[model samples]
Target: MSADLTHVDTWLFDLDNTLYPVESGFMKQAEARMTQFVAKTTGLPMDEAYELQKTYFRDYGLTLHGLMEHHGVDPDEYHAIFHDISLDALAHDTDLLAALQRLPGRRLIFTNADDRHAERVLERLGLSALFDDVFHIGSFGFLPKPDPAAFDRMVEAHGMAPAATAFFEDSERNLEPAAGLGMTTVLVGAHAQDSHASFVHHRTDKLAPFLATARLKEAA
Candidate 1:
């Protein structure tokens, strides 16, 4: 509340670590699946595939992009293989629910994962009804976050005014594009503190507690 959020009319959130705690192991499973797919597709050992996966992610912003560009892999197949994770380890967080409800505006999910993957995560977290729309990687034609094109597609599709938007994400790199687009960028996660960047307008280790601060300070 003290951060001058009055101008923010749209709440744009990243799906993974931003919406749910990273300890939930949701993304860990997806990462393992990505490594497995790369290993099977390229006939490489698991260790080599995992290293390649990490490299692709770092270089291309998305492993799917690297696979498509270098390996001529089908994006759909990679998506299905990588996102085919079990939601058994995940659970609903009512605290996150209350926190989100307190934030004023049209809330939307902007993620690198496909709709199918995003749906499963939201369903598992029992947050399916909270968001207005999910702008997935498919929606951006496979371009991932941190890419200026991806952010452009989101703004065009949602008719979002970047200056009036507040974007919350776990990745500092991702926040750079959002900041350049004029969004009030908030970095979420413990790893968020491991790096320092001018793009980040706010930093919080927990989404619920930070959002709760907005509500509590309003009531005060």
Candidate 2:
């Protein structure tokens, strides 16, 4: 009935949809920006660009990766333009920030977004200082999630033991590999439905309640 944080020393949290609710229009705005970027770079129409972006995300785990592999575009430039949207469109929720601060572990943000974007979002949510560090896309040579190399690098960089870490992500596919590496996996979105690993621990729509219960259980 409560979370056990005993074996978990590092809490790896996903940014975008996991930090904030996807229902918020912030995701939509970011998607639009990505679409526009693709269109501008490829000289395609908006709808085609949007489709291409989706295709790339589906195929390569990140639109930027696909762009790099195919179009030879600069990853930094793509991130700067696509993720430079206003964080003002997102609603403030400090309750989650408080919960994150109270969580019993070294908290780190593991996101596919660039560092600038991650910094902006965390700052807007008043959670910038709560985290030990942020592992952005740029951190691991633009290697995104679902890539074992990226996860491995994150573990090594943070000096974390795979068995003593828990990864909270929005994507089931991403969590699957982390689970395989012996990390407890918490799926934090509707899209994360199927996973073959028992280490895939919790599935929650929101993180605040989960964190509160986990903290209470730890106290008890």
Positional deviation of residue 80's Cα in model 1 after best superposition, in angstroms: 1.6
Q: Counting only residues 3 or more apart in sequence or on different chains, how many pairs clash (N, Cα, C under 3 Å) in candidate 2? A: 0
lDDT of 1 by residue, 1-220 (tens): 4456777778999998888878877788888888888898889999999999989999989888888888999888878775556788788888988888887778899999889989988988888988999999999999888899999999999999999899999889999999999999999997877767988998888888787766222321
Q: How good is model 1 by TM-score?
A: 0.93
Candidate number achieving the greatest lDDT relative to the actual structure: 1
**What is the lDDT, from 0 to 100, of the residue 8 in candidate 1?**
75
Considering only N, C-alpha and C atoms within 3 Å, which residue pairs clash in candidate 1?
none
Worst 10 residues of 2 by lDDT: 211-220
lDDT of 2 by residue, 133-162 (tens): 999998888888888999989988988988
Give the per-residue Cα lDDT of candidate 1 at 20.
83
Rate residue 122 of model 2 by lDDT.
89
How much is the lDDT of residue 156 in candidate 1?
A: 100
**What's the true lDDT of residue 7 in model 1?**
77
* TM-score quality measure for candidate 2: 0.91
Please, what is the TM-score per model? 0.93, 0.91
